[model samples]
Target: MSKTFLKKRYGLLVLALTASGVALATVSQPDLPVAAAYKTERVVQELPMPKLTINANASSYWRDEEVRTGDTLALVLQRLGVSATSIQNFTKSSPIDLKTLELRAGQIVSARVDSVGDVTDIQFFRDDDNGERNLAAIERINGKWQLNTSNIDMETMPSLRSVVITSSSSGALSRAGVPVEIRTSLKEMFSEKFNLDELVEGDSVSLLYESLYFRGQEVATGDVLAAEVRTQGKTYRAYYFEHGDTGGNYYDENGNSLTRGFDGQPIENFKRISSPYGIRRHPVLGSIRMHTGIDYAAPIGTHILAPSDGVVTFSGWKGGYGNTVMLTHDNGVETLYGHMHAYVRGVNVGTRVKAGDVIGLVGSTGRSTGPHLHYEVRINGQHVNPATVALPTPKLSAADLAALKKYQQKTDETMAAVRGLPVMVAQRD
Candidate 1:
């Protein structure tokens, strides 16, 4: 964009914020009004006290604790106020192998502790015998500890969160309960627009995302639906729009597309691009052959995520690329993931997945010598170098603009829910 356009964009404040709409928020406060017609009266009644049971928890409440780095089973239980005896019983009685429990930071563990500091029940998830993570819980049943490992039906819901910038963006997002996956998307969206580290103290951040709940507890978080960051006297926002069974893209309120490139990276935290697209030298074959995909070197079991929303057209083994998965997307675009250790459970043919959703694990499975992920992008079945994909600022048609406005209606509803609690409080006036 030209300097003149940038100046005009920044000059437009709030109501005229963008071509789509202004990012709005209000603190959640419900007002209770007193009834003027009712007269006040005081009454007291005497009642007999019932007998209390000894050595029983009179007040049991739920407490949540997050697993941290270098934390052990005992440490987590101790932090949750579980007594030593109860912790010992929990370990010995858990259906899943407590000794083999691998603690990953950021996982929430919920426990019910009594007034005396004895744990009555605790809920957590861990890798099962088959290497699949499943929800498991230990509860006191008839004075004996029992374990239950069952898959609870998941419920999908929308989540909105906001925070005033006061230190680092990551810390602020974490304190606001934004999921790590959603945080990544938010950062990527604004990475090209501004530097988050340079944001001033009063600048605010807000986000809308998809949340998954299992048995009333949030099990996982999905894609970021929308996000806004107010900094340097201006508000920049992006909204995610799903194009039916095809895929979704991020756009400014004005309906122009906004993304780092044509699409996002398939997996984050890869060591390096072990091999780039195009033919040079074949490592295993020792012959110059066409290298059709980009190889991302990462440790085995590292998650492979979908670059965008799409439906799985293929999920199985193929010639040299072992355990491959292929997805078909809009605009005749398709993506392929090869050399996988294993596919994420339930991500089979015809399964619809969103960007950031795990599809497989990284590994060296086919015609290779070490662990790496082979990612390929195909348009109309023709191979395109992933590294050369460029960002396009295409013009929107009249119908397209109308559809974009219709999509804004959804975000407008989300904005209203947070309208009273403005994140950019200092600049609201």
Candidate 2:
């Protein structure tokens, strides 16, 4: 063979062997991990929880009612959602004398009944010199009936207001932001002493009174501490003085009692006068006849109060009068009440009652047309017009006069505080 051909073959074989060694070295090398692109960390926080409250004595249902004129203890309790058995249990277990409870009209009554229509608690409030200090409760404790009497801690604050009578007494007092009860009390205080109907447009009045607060809210208005009324260049002042046994009465600066001895109308706050005490056309008889007594038109079962202090002479069914009641007063005066639905319990013959006492319930059980009271006032067997009769005023005792003078000083201090204008917001609990 030729020497040049051999040299070219040898150079080709060396180049191919060098390329294979470089590829083997690249395939056998280990891989390295790449660095992460982001980092992370955890965070936590805590929050507070709220508190909850619950009332222990609250029942599933509650009811409230007002004492009616003909309401007995059982009737009132029944109206307040108390069961018949519950009422019997309460009356038997009660420690208070039910007979001594003067259940007057307009009294508030409250009851709490369970889901099964069973009364759980029944409560009634009464007032004294300390302002609603007595609480009568009839409740079920540990599945047994119980009656408890407790004293309520009331916060009493004095309030004052002065107003000029531009037109209406109630209106002017209302404009001055006086409460309805307070205005009523003020009117009643001076009703006998001064003629409210004779008040002119320019008359002025200043009043100092008390307000009862419970749980930061005003619950009731207390007695009128003092009042000053100016009419026709004359001023009349009344201050309330409390005397033990003699009772509380409003007395003037000279210690003269302002309350009248006799209430002319037999029914206080009557609806209207249906018939006068004169010759009038009979509604049922359809003829002109003499109406010996005044007729007070009112709703059924309305209260019939006594006109004066007297003893019950007769209480029973009478001809044309149905349930009739006769009272004998001082000086041979006789008052008769006719067509009564019912007579007051324990008010039989020889029962002595004071003025404003509930004697009977108005009804139309006899020969009548509707619910009304046939009130007759006879002086020596002669009927007189009750509307025109002049009532007498009683004189104050020496002890009452002496006590009133001392009370006047306290009223003066209260009036001085009242003159500051804009009754301060009562801070009470």
- Root-mean-square deviation per candidate: 24.3, 21.8
> TM-score per candidate, in order?
0.54, 0.38
Off by over 4 Å in 2: 1-153, 197-201, 263-399, 417-429
Residue-level lDDT tens digits of model 1 in 1-429:
689855654465433546667564533333346667968899999999999779665598887777778888779989988889888877777656667787657666778889888887777655322112345556787777776433334556777777877787778767766655456557656666886667767788777776555556665554567777888888888877654322356788898776545444687664577766543423443322345567788999999988777899999887568889988765346788888899999999999988778999988777666888888765444454454332223446788778878877776676556542534211110
Tens-place lDDT digits, model 2, residues 66-120: 5667676668878866778777877777656776675545455667776545677
Q: Quick one: RMSD of model 1?
A: 24.3
Local distance difference test, each candidate? 0.67, 0.65
Query: Between which residue pairs do clashes occur in model 2?
Result: none
What is the model-wide C-alpha lDDT for candidate 2? 0.65
* Model 2 steric clash total: 0
Where does candidate 1 clash, by residue pair?
20-253, 25-418, 25-419, 25-421, 26-418, 26-419, 26-420, 26-421, 27-420, 27-421
Q: List where candidate 1 sits over 4 angstroms from the true fold.
A: 1-51, 55-57, 124-133, 137-140, 143-153, 262-401, 419-429
Q: Model 1 Cα displacement at 373 (Å)?
A: 10
What's the lDDT for residue 164 in model 1? 79
